[model samples]
Target chain A: MSDSPSARASRTTGTVRIVGAGLLGASIGHALRRQDVDVVLADVSPSQLRLAIDYGAGRDARDDDRPGLVVVAVPPDVTADVVQAELEAHPEAVVTDVASVKLEPFTELRRRGVDLTRYIGSHPLAGRERGGAISARADLFIGRPWVVCRDEETRAADLAVVEALALDLGAMPLEMTPQEHDRSVALTSHVPQVVASLLAARLASAEPGSLSLAGQGVRDTTRIAASAPELWVQILSANAGPVVEVLDALASDLREVSDALREPDAPGARRTIADAIRQGNEGVSLLPGKHGQNRRFEQLIVMVDDTPGQLGRLFGELGELGVNVEDLRLEHSPGAQFGLADISVAPDALRGAVEGLEARGWRIAGNTND
Target chain B: MSDSPSARASRTTGTVRIVGAGLLGASIGHALRRQDVDVVLADVSPSQLRLAIDYGAGRDARDDDRPGLVVVAVPPDVTADVVQAELEAHPEAVVTDVASVKLEPFTELRRRGVDLTRYIGSHPLAGRERGGAISARADLFIGRPWVVCRDEETRAADLAVVEALALDLGAMPLEMTPQEHDRSVALTSHVPQVVASLLAARLASAEPGSLSLAGQGVRDTTRIAASAPELWVQILSANAGPVVEVLDALASDLREVSDALREPDAPGARRTIADAIRQGNEGVSLLPGKHGQNRRFEQLIVMVDDTPGQLGRLFGELGELGVNVEDLRLEHSPGAQFGLADISVAPDALRGAVEGLEARGWRIAGNTND
Candidate 1:
């Protein structure tokens, strides 16, 4: 009830127009329409516009309506053209885009000689495996990072309006330049997607019995491989340089490991393989924990039956015990009748949490601080 | 409670002598000792043996005792030596080792001109990120696959004894040859580990701002990268041929993607990238669903606050409605105030499940079949 669109809409005021009735576009309209602000929707595809309108996203853009802000939410390939069109049509409006790639569109717009003062590029790192207006949600951006790209040419008032939009949608607004945003996403998002897809592709012609022994590690590493291929092609092609840089570095590391593995018994060969893995250990350890905190917590494993209310009962008992669960992970084997719940709690609360859960008849299988 | 070792031990009868008191060895001793079976623990390191005994994994091994089964649970580097010694010392016992690799030891024993009829090679695909008897769990192998490798010379009665041990430890026993086991694990385990570690290694030198946008996808892809480098070096080296084959194929694919991205505007560039990603989709789709069933379920997404009892209330309501949750996944942003709980249910139960939760004031954001 707290995340209801109507409740969130009261915090913002403006006439916002969305120019693409796809997932991001329709979702932005849906989130903004519930607020007191005026919203206009437009799309090249009449059917998509109709669908978004039927879903209560927004009304069709009328020629007489003067929007204060225009959000271009189209595929990366067509993002630059749409942003140019939106800016030309709404000369006074501050324009922003929700494209995943930022620098390419910015460069294209600048190449087209568009006014730079009112344009901002932003990306909200929130999406599902599916796409289209049918899958759009008003709360999709809630609590996710919405990076806003700006430079010295950006006006403070224009930047303020864009930040307000991100805030009204309950997304955290982070500021970065176009180059920085593109490079950052290349490291964190683009490279991982390509690596996952490549790893999964190797299994395409694998022996029939090879996958039967698949465990959680391989499953997690390749989970994102199920994402749409066509969408990724566009994203990867748009930011090819940065993505290729990261992939090349990883490929070099792979070559070293492969060579060392080929001659494992040779002198210093084991050391080569160990060095790469140790680098991985150091890199993964740098990731922030929940709430962007760097501190580690003790994990307590509890076994739960495959019943609907079993997890509910466990959490209820923990809540009654006044233990604050920092994070939680669930692991289950295929065909298993039960699952393991790894609950992370503050170090000081680990003993109390284990005792309380055990007293409530929950079996504590193990606990670890690493 | 059902997974308790005492309840499981009644199904088997034998004395188990474990030859190493590390994580796997100590855990086996702990599990076997809880049952009616007598467990004798030994290790090359006196302090480790003493610690395992103090932790109640098992009693110290006595020379006068005659064990029916001998488990060689040493590191991969010493697996062959330990297995040979165990087989030589206990001539009447059926011997097995819990090393991750299979072919090297089998080849080693064969090269030594030893009679291999009594030695069985097995690997239990269960482990924690950390190692040591202190981090051992009696239920570590519960519902996980424990692969047993045997040759034509192996007796049926001897194989039965090994299978019984796997079952008595609450693990599912799978049968494979030494070659098949090594090849399968190379594809599913070793290759993924290298891929994850290499991907994480790229992040080691990334810009400070790049990691702030790291999402669940990258986090999961690299989670296992934190494993000890020395342990992985031993595993990768032991299965070098098969692992190198997989990595070489993956490297070729990486090169193709990189070349295509470098000249995205070239002829058929987009097609090349799309083809690789499509192959990934096909490969990942072949994975078995939960419970080893190929059927798909409808997923319902519910937003829950970050409070302790919020999940409990949602699950409690589902329980009251008698709706069974087939699978569950939780996603939360780093600093988000709420998390999304995606609960999967049987397709036929979708309507009823949604209605039940909605009636209890739960908001249904969206649902999907994919």
Candidate 2:
């Protein structure tokens, strides 16, 4: 949640031009327009431009209009070309691109001997399963990381303008070099997607009965594997170097695990298996907890009947007791008539929340603190 | 959510003797005792047996007691030995072990020339992160799959006894041969665990800034990597053959993807990458939905404020509207005060639920059906 539009004066000025009226472009248009900033939409496809305009994203760009900012939000394959074109077309304006991968296009432009002073490469780590102008939302970037890749050649004013754009869209602006941005996302996003996809691919040929015994582990691990291949191919190809590095390391680790399992009783084999899993424990612990804290939330699993209002009653009761649910997950089995609602709360609030719910006649199936 | 204790007459008859007194053993004891069945508990550790008894899991084993059914619930490493000992100690009793792997122990027994006519191997696909009697719950097996490995040599009466145990403890019993059980779990459970761990292990050396950019994708893929190494080493080693098979295939797939990314412009490189991801899409679709259906429930994303009562009010309103939420996932950002609650419901209920929530002043951020 953020403040209403125009809660503060806009740091961005003048008419903003957005090329490629797809999800990112249309979303930026919508957010900027919500703040009553002038936005001009442009797309190679007339129908896409019309659709984005009809969605109230922005007005059509006019030939004579002089814009102060240009945003290239096209596919990764065409991002560098469009960014270069936009920079040439609006030489006086600050230009930026919101592609998923930052370094590829940045390097491409540098290789082309293009002027880099007016252009900044950035990526907002925000998206939905579906894409297009039709799926655009004004708040898509709220509270999400928007990485800004800047270099010594980038002017302070141009950098400020890009950061201001991120802030205007409710995104947290994080500065990272092009190399750093590429490496960070390779570890965090790109490799995870590849691993998830490969793992899920294994399941396509799995027997149905074997799949019937699927629990939360397989479901969570492979959920992202359902992403669009067309979109991922472009993104993966763009960040190939870093992505391959991680994938290669992962494959090596997997082989070690396989080898260790194959001869678990052999000297040092069990130790290899144990170390891999133990390393995972240490690695997962490094992740920041929800709410940007290092501590993990205490989880309470409460049983809820499948009937319509059971969860409502439980949450309603929790509300009455002044207990905030920081996060919630509903676990349901294939044949179960009831589900388990795993409610997470701050550590200090766990006891009170559990006691309150229990007193309200809710069964506290289990809790982490217990 | 199952029938209250003794709502129906249990098919399981006679006293049940449970060995090991760990999570599974203690949990079985608790469930049987709740059904008014006499239970005798044993463990190699006296403190563990005392703890289970003090927790009301069961009574201590007596010298003269005769058990009609004996459940060996020790660690996977000693499962065969314990099952063999239980069968020898209770010659008249139907014996079963709850080790994760089936074929290894069964083969071990067969190699020892032990009679297994009274022995059944079953594994309940249920567990918590923490183990031991302190983490045990009577309803651990409710609605979960309990795989029973049976052979032609096993008597029908003995097979029925094991199935009855599963049913009485609120599990669905699925019969399979030891080989089938091993292969099934190797694909579904064991392989996922190894993959998750190996992937998460890559994060150990990653920079904290990179980790700070982590999203739901990484979190879900690596969630199970936190499981105990001591337990997993035994399970993976016992199911090594099948586990290694899947791991080997997965590693091969990863190498192909890496090679493709290394030369994405080479003929068929892009195709290979696309095909891997496309296969993943197909594979993920094979998984059953939460309600045991092939159909996916439509999802609606609603923005909920950080306040204590916002989610409670939202669920309460949905309850009043008679729209049952099939599954719920909360998406929160590190810096955001509010989170997005993605609620899944029946496809037909989408329109009405959206209209109702909109009229109730709830902002529906997005929906899948759109």
The candidate maximizing lDDT is 2
Give lDDT tens digits, candidate 2, residues A1-370: 4543346677788999999999899999999998888999999999989999999999987888898899999999999999999889998999999999999999899899999899999999999998989989888888889999889998998899999999998888999988888888898889989999988899887865888888889989999999999999999999999999999999999999888877888999999999999998988888777767776788999989998888889998989988899888888767878888989898899999989988878878788876
DockQ leader = 2
Clashing pairs in 1: A9-A35, A335-B291
Model 2 off-target regions past 4 Å?
Answer: A1-6, B1-6
TM-score (all chains, Cα) for each model: 0.97, 0.99
Clashes of 2: 0
Displacement of residue A77 (Cα, Å) in model 1 is 0.8
lDDT of 1: 0.86
**Who wins the TM-score comparison?**
2
Against the true two-chain complex, what DockQ does each candidate achieve?
A: 0.67, 0.80
Q: Give candidate 1's error at residue A215 in angstroms.
A: 0.8
Clash count for each candidate, listed in order shown: 2, 0
